[model samples]
Target: MRTVKDAWMMVQSEYRGNKLKLVWASLFSIFYMGYIAFFVGIMMNEIVQSNEGHMAVDIMLLSITPLMGFVLNRSAFKYWSEDSYTRMLVYFKSLPIPATVILCKRKIMSVIAFSINGTLCFGLIYAFSKNMRAEMDLGDYIAFTITWIGYGLIVTGLYITFELLFSGKIYLVLTLAVLIVAFGVAFLVQMGGGNLFLYTILCSQEWGLLSPLMWGTLLVGMASVQVFSKWTIHRLKSRDLL
Candidate 1:
């Protein structure tokens, strides 16, 4: 469709002169994930071999894998910041294309980035698990990878909404505050011996790949994307981007 073509063109325009940056980003993301995989492999080996309480640690690592996409491939956030700085949103708004198309380009880029990041993170983990003769199988790896990608997409949608709604120093401050709150909550949960929602979802494979929780996670992710996309478009159209 022409709309999809326009969105793709917009994405291309954003990366027009940033091929080198993209390459570096890709390499950095790979190296970062490689380091995590190595670290996780070491921890997994020790945990699997020991009879200590490793379930919490395993849950923490598995929960963190999906979030690594956001931490490493921050290109989407950077691009949004750049667009805001240059008033590119205003320029795009002046165009004949719908606001949905304008935002679609960013979402497409996000999906691509998160998919690659999620695959590398989980693929490397799976490779290490197999080498250690861990209990995981290809099916479990596939389910984890898909679920992580879905969770990444859902987080990206919320992140994009925040970027659109807030800009400049306010956004930076808010982001820092959010990180603090998240870390604080996580620490509390760990101290209290409470399980993370992600832990439940990730371990849902024990009931097989056809688990209702897995399906629900995917459904929630898909629905969240749709809701966030519509909300973003509405906000962009109503905002005075000038």
Candidate 2:
């Protein structure tokens, strides 16, 4: 398709100058994530063993563990700095490409990146936890991978929207604020008792991979990417590039 060709061209263009650096960065990210996953696996193994009655909480923790790599690597390094991202946007804008195509490429890239990273990270966790008392089976590992990749897509959509709409400083401030609020709410929920959200997700897993809840979550994530892409296109058309 024309769109696929355009996206491939865009990817090549984006990586034209610094392909080696990007590759190295990606390798480092994988290494760091693997290292962290190993420790987290051990910790989760202990927690699951200790919390015999709270299987829902354990499942919830395991499900979201893949995201920890993203958070950790993001704190330490960036795959694309703001200046580099700005330059890429400017260059792409000057080209004879449609906004939809540009945005579609980004979404597709995000999905691929998260898919690879999430799989490797989760695989490490699963491998490391094999000797533990409360280890998950192969089926649970696969289910968690599918579920969290959906969650990662939703995050990627929001993060791309934020990058488009705000400057570096404001974006960083807002990101920190969002993280603080999320952690605060989650902590409060834990202090009050077990998380209702976790319980709901855990219950949803009863139907295995065919669960409507799981599929619904994936659909929501995909819909979010589409909505965000459209919104970004509109914003770009309506305003001057930063």
Candidate 3:
């Protein structure tokens, strides 16, 4: 309990004075979702649902929440890597916590962020369901949301590992550009996996049995995150912090 509290404080500390950014971000989420619910939803309903291809666009949008989270998570390691000049590293290291614990907390934060986005994404889908004339019911909605989160966990591990490897003292713009390209390519790959997962989930609903493959995929995703967390800690122990 105490460790969780400490980690929460560490995460919150990053936002020390970034009030405006937080407010604006929250506002943007609200407005973007509201616009989708009212306007986009209505227009999207016009499309006749003939084939599974009708859901391609929605699945693509659903993938973005985690892809963005993966990039956003780099901020944590970016700060850690810049500790020599930033000196914020000293404060974090001085805590009784190990480097791995700090990273675990960051991963937790990423999951939480993705959870909120997934919830909103689910809401957006349901809002437009009638318009899109979606055939999915409430149970399918729950499964989809939970499955996306598992996928997000896998994505978070993969991207953060890459971030820790390539991150260094470089121009922020260049770094972002590199990440944008990388994320774009990765999103393409993830979309393929998500498409398969979604189709399976939709089909299995008729039989009222989610296949073991789905559960296995979720387990693989969870394991990837756990393994990578340990990998990050091992790497951290060997590196010197400024």
Candidate 4:
């Protein structure tokens, strides 16, 4: 109980420090997502009027916002892992805390933060589209928003682990290079012969497969948080902090 309480306090402190930053980030993302949605609505109108082009554009536009948001959150998490908060994490884990308790607090905080951002983004898009008569309904939008939050958490956790792995300057260059290549691969897959947009759209369908993917990602993220907490505690035990 004490450990859990401590973990909660730690989470609260972190959130309090970043509350303003979170609010601004949420606002920025909401506007950015709204802009993307507006652009998509225009393109959709053009395609409909011209009676040409595949439905892939629609898919790409819809999925791009979430994908971009997820990656941004991951990058942010990586950045934060290098900050003082992570050093504090080492200390926190060294205490009598059950690793899972700390892990849960972090995950819960992440979900709450990401969910707020996702909700704002969705709200902006919905408000902007009030006059456009878009085909999307409330239930579908809510489900997609949840999926976005889940995927963001998973990606953020993975990035946090990598940040720990490459804490030094030497590995930072390698990390950037790898991320560049990853983005290039994604671009090639989508613009090359692959129809990634179509797949994204299919996954967004009412009976789509995104739910399973989201749940699987959440489980994987939880496991990763546990592993990382253990490894971090072990690493800290080997080093002395004056």
Best by TM-score: 2
- Candidate 4 residue lDDT tens string, 98-186: 55565556555555545655665556655554432354466555554455555455455544444444443433565466456556655
Q: Count of backbone clashes for each model?
A: 0, 0, 1, 0
Report the C-alpha lDDT of model 3 over 1-242, residue by residue, as the tens digit. Answer: 66667777777766677876567665665665555445534434443244333343444444453553531333444553663222443456676566666776767767666665556655776676583335556665565556656666676676555444333454344445645654565467555654443464465455333745446556877898778877877776655554
Between 2 and 3, whose lDDT is larger? 2
Which scores better on TM-score, 1 or 2? 2
Ten consecutive residues with minimal summed lDDT in candidate 3? 47-56
In model 4, the number of clashes is 0
Q: Write the per-residue lDDT of candidate 1 for residues 201-241, one digit (tens) a residue.
A: 34655855765656676678767777887898887766765
- lDDT value, residue 33 of candidate 2: 66
RMSD to the hidden true structure, all candidates: 4.0, 4.2, 5.8, 5.9
What's model 4's lDDT at 44?
49
- How does model 4 score by TM-score? 0.59
What's the C-alpha lDDT at position 209 in model 4?
Answer: 38
Off by over 4 Å in 2: 13-19, 52-82, 131-134, 195-205
TM-score of 2: 0.79
1 against 4, candidate with superior TM-score: 1
Q: Which stretches of candidate 3 lie over 4 Å from their true place?
A: 15-21, 31-48, 52-65, 68-91, 94-97, 131-133, 168-198, 201-204, 207-214, 240-242
Q: After superposition, how far is residue 109 of candidate 2 from its true place, in Å?
A: 1.2
